[model samples]
Target: MSTASTKKPPEVRLPPKPDLELRLDKFAQLATIFLSLVGLLFVLKTGSFLLAPVSLAIVVGLMLAPVALRLEDIGLPPSLSAAAVVLIFVLVTGSIAAAIAAPLASWAARVPQIWNELQLQLQLTSFSEPLATIRSVREEIRNVTGEPNVTVSVQDGSPVESVAVLAPALLAQVLIFFASLYFFVATRHDTRLAILKMCSGRRIRWRAAHVFRDVEGLVSNYLLSIAIINIGLGVTVAVVLWLLNVPSAPLWGAIAGVLNFFIYIGPALMAVILLGVGLASFDGMPGILLPPLAYLALNAIEAQIVTPMTIGKRMTLNPFIIFLAVAFWLWIWGPVGGFIAIPALLILFALARNLIPGFPWGMPEERRRRLSRLP
Candidate 1:
């Protein structure tokens, strides 16, 4: 009894609880974003062969969706409506291509002569020192790398052989593109339903629905509006070019119309091209400056006046953000990247708005802290 009484009570221990501080799980979120970006870049780079066409088709399909919707409202079957829309799109594209082809061919044939003339003209300029410096730097890099003194002579295949080699892949991309567009248009409702099904609650479903509708409406309307404006820009340029007696006015107009979709850089590039062509075609500074200057004026009006009035201030994006998006995508995928960049930005903007509800873009400190409260 004495020995039992002398024994001390058993030692007790408990697992420590984590601190329940009111801090955001910033590390986890940052890691998730980082990983997601890495994965996206990998897929984009590796699957570019398939993904580029698919992306283009999706953007095109979104633009054509209203036609399909209107047809459906008139009691056409979804498949039939989608088919009709796709057919119309194809016809329009083909017609434009046909219209531009002859002029483009003519311009292409003149490129060598233009290049020669440009070189001759530039020789009397201050550019010679920079060119020599560039050559010297290139040689230095070559010597440092211990590169072989190799001349790569491109083996010129027959045109027929080149076409044969390229045709299958090009054909496949076209098929995939059309197929994706048709399916997306026909099954849009199903896609929406599937998205909603992934959500567990009414609130989530509602938000998802809202996001889907917002994406569809914003993307389609923005694209349509931009298309109309761009068409007008092209027509104006064509008329002006014709008045100026530019040899391939239609081709330049078409090029301007397409390139204008890529903001800032596109117009600058078009100006450069026009300037080069001007130099090639005309003798003096007045003749050389006219086309690009006229274009600049027209573009300024369209950008500053027409677009804002049409697209609305609400739809406008930050110039810095747009520039970054364009640069990033262009570095990754060239022209295709540029084409998708704005649409992608719109989609992301829509998503961010939906996710955070009234979060200001240039978020202040207090607002930034509120991101933790985002649904």
Candidate 2:
């Protein structure tokens, strides 16, 4: 038998290929893009809730990290050390609030009275004389031209109602701030370690370390300098108000100091408040003019001399960028956003320096030279 024609038909075979692998790779890329877009949208939409507490926490943590480290050096466990830091923060904040609370309340009560007094002062001032002349001119024109009947519309709302609405918002903000601070203090080490682990390669690791160190130094220094400057501002404002015989001088001063955190806008708002107070309490242009003048002088000194000296080139950011950051955050999250803008900018600059090699801004030439020189 011819092997009984048992020769089997040639077995069929398929070519080996990498279609599955390619498909998987494409899917992963798509997934990554999708996730990133989702994250970005979430941040843009709900940023106000996340940004405020996060910014406050970061600031608080930066300010307290040294203290926590010191406590650790003295043999305290990390958790205890963190707790101690939180306690200290709470106590300091509480004491400051307590110290200012009564005076602020008193000032709040006196605002309406002050407003009335300020109106009277404005009526008597040299500035008011121009208004009187304008009125006379208008009357003469009306008399000669023959007056036409005019009607006015008024909207009615009580100021107290506005205050009532604001109170809850303020309280909620305070609550969020404190809670965030506590959590930041408690988790700072974990956060740092996680960030470090996320980095790969020796150069990346070193860059991360450098960037974090710079952030720590810059934020701590900035906060300390701000605290000192604000205290001085508050004291100066209080002294001036007292000398000028303004009621609740300390309260106004404290307000000025606190608001100064928001930079140009804060001072402008405070100027309006001071102008109103002057109109209520004093009797002429001097009253209105003096507050604005005093604020201008103090701010000029702070901006030109004290800030430059204390902050130095280490943290110098472009003024235009700073202003835009302020505006952006203010638009996104209002006053709290403005307060956090500088520190947020610092964090952003630091991250960019690390993540994006050879970024143009914020890379100090001298520092590079020194680094290059090091063995």
Candidate 3:
């Protein structure tokens, strides 16, 4: 008691309270970021209808730019020149589609026979044991479901009818794309000027122009080179199929050409189809294996040799980025998205590189390093 009375009570000190406004501001910032992410996802999910047309327009513009430029060089007005290029593209695409329809129809009609041949080939090859195992698994599934009579059918209907039904939609899409491309080409200069005006400073405007030019050159060159390479691959496949006496060789080749747009998955699917057809047409494993081997060889040449040589130095994309882009687009818009993924990626990469300082953005240094490491 005496000690307590002699000692002055130490002044109790409490920590300062956090500022509510600052805390609230930090929370608000986090919420805004989360909501923005959600909004972006929603747009991607629902915006395919809009994106499809725009993407198609970009591709069409790339393919037609040279033609339009040539027409302009010959003294045609830009608008008229763009129109001429679009018309030629439409006509050529239509002709090719029409020419291949009948052969594709034949191939579709023969699906049942093809399956049977594939079954026979599997029975004769090293796959026989695996096929038996699969049969056993199917039997177990049937037993578990109490449906012993369950049968699977893989047959498809007439390819011509399928094409006919889809033709209107395809035509509408083409028209929209071409119309948009025409405007884009005609107004490209004005568009650049507008962009420059909107930018805050000279440095930004200069960077924007450089990025635009780079994107245009990359996309145009990629489109032309891919077209040539795909055509060559198609012809090669067609010749091989014809030599092998495969039915509807031209149709298969056309399918190959279209599928080639999808990269790794495309060639794999074509190989499966070829194997099936070979099995149906031939009685031995040798025949069945030929299609896959031929496709593998052709793809190897295209991927390893042709693409590298033709697209050299200019096509500077990270493989992982390309794969991710393809997957993302395919998830959003199915096969159409898959077909346009590369060009879409190129545009995005160009924009990102121009806008961000630290990012690689498909630059020459990055591309050269990547190619140097490739086998």
Report the number of clashing residue pairs per model. Answer: 0, 5, 0
After the best TM-score superposition of candidate 1, give how far the Cα of residue 132 lies from its true spot, in angstroms.
7.1
Give stretches of model 1 more than 4 Å off: 1-29, 124-164, 263-269, 300-312, 361-375
| Tens-digit lDDT string for candidate 2 (251-327) | 88988888888866788898888877766666667666787678678878887777766654546677668779878
Instruction: For model 3, state the Cα shift of residue 28 in Å.
Output: 6.6
Residue pairs with backbone overlap in model 1: none
Off by over 4 Å in 3: 1-35, 119-174, 242-251, 304-313, 358-375
TM-score: model 3 vs. ground truth: 0.73
* Model 3 clash tally, residue pairs: 0
**lDDT-best of 1 and 3:** 1
lDDT of 3: 0.78
Q: Candidates 1 and 3: which is better by TM-score?
A: 1
- For candidate 2, the 10 contiguous residues with the lowest summed lDDT are 366-375
Q: In what order do the candidates fall by lDDT, top score first?
A: 1, 3, 2
What is the C-alpha lDDT profile of model 1 across 193-272, one tens digit per residue?
A: 98899998666666677678777887898888889999999989988988998868878888788778877678999998
lDDT of 2: 0.78
Enumerate residue pairs that collide in model 2.
114-280, 117-279, 117-280, 118-279, 118-280
Q: Which has the better TM-score: candidate 2, or candidate 3? A: 3
